[model samples]
Target: MEPDFPLRKIIHVDMDAFYASVEQLDNPDLRGKPIAVGGSSQRGVVSAASYEARKFGVRSAMSSVIAKRNCPELIFVKANFERYKEISKAIRQIFYDYTDLVEPLSLDEAYLDVTINKKGNPSATLVAQEIRQRIFDELQLTASAGISINKFIAKVASDYNKPNGQKTVNPEEVIQFLEDLEIRKFYGVGKVTAEKMYKLGIFTGRDLKTKSLEFLDQKFGKSGNHYYHVVRGIHTSEVKPHRIPKSVGAERTFSENLSSEIFMLERLEHIAQELERRLKKSKIAGKTITLKIKYSDFSLQTRSKTLPYFISDKDLILETAKNLLYQNSLENSVRLLGISLANLNTERKETINGEKEVSVQLKFDF
Candidate 1:
């Protein structure tokens, strides 16, 4: 066995088809049937899909039209974020009972470092099983968990026996487990990165392990170092209790594409109002305002301007967005409009003279 690997007992718990499962739990009629949680309108997108819907290739972020076409009888349910948040809070409470080092990735997933949990239980595997069972018993929702020495492996292992199961990658097996895994299945390797890896003849963790750090750095930059470390079971990120937001934004897709700026004024105003409300809810303000434009032909464009002072008012956001809108000629008819704020107040770091220095977190460093 490799001697340097940390012996922490980390578990990644992910709720199975969370939003869809919540809908099914509340409305029994939707159980065991193909359902999507989102609108079925022309411009709507699927936020979640049940297991039955997944069988037909219906997935989150898919267009409503394509989802329905994929599953002819797919039922569309409007999303209830408030209910999801309530359940998420309850789930966090459950985690707190076991460990204080709990890190939530989203409403449906979290990482628990149970190496020294409150339960006084030594076996991480058993703790995972008990947690899964408790969730089912209390919330009537099934969750899957992955247990390993670190966050990356645990996150990937969680999906091994999904929907209602857990997988544990023991310390002795960690190296072999990662080496034998498919490159595409690595947690951070998305479709684009996987394709790039395939082009470079990196098909699996073993293949990735063969490359020199210098070679990887040249090809993939800093991410190459992360891959070089993780494939050898070397991810060192701690499970953080407070996950900060990188940006806040709101967007709306129109039922009918608008050709003229005059026709989009009202839509932009409403979007600004929504964005302002979100900023206030989070108690956040930002200096950078970005306007995202999605054309009818599916092309995307963004315009951003940074301010000297933080602002979260609807009027300011709307005015800045309008300026960005008229800053350039429309490339094509607009199908979607969005407003975002970044360089957030939350990102301020303590500096000398009682001032704050804004910093950006390196997201690619695993």
Candidate 2:
């Protein structure tokens, strides 16, 4: 652990194949069978896959066509978001028993700051273990956890032994664990970023550490700073209970491809209306409005404009989206239309000084 960064006990709890597992848990016949939680249509995408489906290379975000090609017998099940939310609420209640500092990344995953917990537990590792056990015992669902000194490390460690397991990165082993970790395994390093790192001869954290801050900045811009610090075990981000969303968006994938600009305008109006409703529900507005287009061929494009003043009205959002839709000629027939608002009113625009030396012990009783 870096001396400059504050130490805190963080645990990242991630449900194991959440959606697919839920489907299996509710239906006895679906258990141990290869199932995908999504439509098995050409236009549909797989939202999740059970462990049985994963063995055949079926995964979330994969096209249903491709997933079927991978596994001929893969069963496709429609997603039940309402039921999933019901289970998620129950799971969160279990977290509230241990700590108040719970940051939900999504319905299936969250970060918990349990440095000072209700149970008066000194070991974060044991706390995570108990949480996982409670989830299985009460909900009949499995979850994985990562216990570590910071949220970033804990998030990555949580995936180390996934699908109903947990891993803890002790303070003394943080440096070595990161050094040996593959670049692709680092949190926030997606396939494209991993490819970029590989091209720079940075296949591992040890390789990333060899580059100076200036060099990484030149290569990756603002994200380079994040990479440089995280590689050295210096992520200082706290586990905020009320996580502010960076953007609010709504998109619709049409049942059939739409070609006419007039038709798209109608869809954009509907999308903007939905966006406005979401923004209003959250009591948020944004200065930036972006229109996302997904073509019939599955190609994607986005156009954005930033306004001087925030707006959450449906008419305003529709007006901006309509303008952006007309800003450029369509490359192909559009299949999906989306509107997103960024530079939100809820964002905390404060900066944290990274150089401040905070001396806190990384190793607790664990």
User: Which of the numbered candidates is closest to the native, going by highest TM-score?
Assistant: 2
The candidate scoring highest on lDDT is: 2
Each model's lDDT: 0.88, 0.90
CA lDDT for candidate 2: 0.90
What 10-residue stretch in candidate 1 is worst by lDDT? 357-366
Candidate 1 wrong stretches, greater than 4 Å:
1-6, 348-366
lDDT of candidate 1 over 245-322, digit per residue (tens): 879999998888899899888899999999999999999999999999989887889999999999999999999999
| Model 2 TM-score (2 dp) | 0.95
Question: What lDDT tens digits, residue by residue, belong to model 2 across residues 1-366?
Answer: 338656789999999999999999999899999999986756677899999999999999787888999999999998999999999999999999999999999999999999999999999999999999999999999999999999999999999898899999998788889889999999999999999999999999999989988899999998877887887778878899999999999998787789999898888888888998898999999999999999978889999999999999999999989999999999999888899999998889655436332333354566
Q: Any residue pairs clashing in model 1, and if so which? A: none
In model 1, the Cα lDDT at residue 8 comes to 79
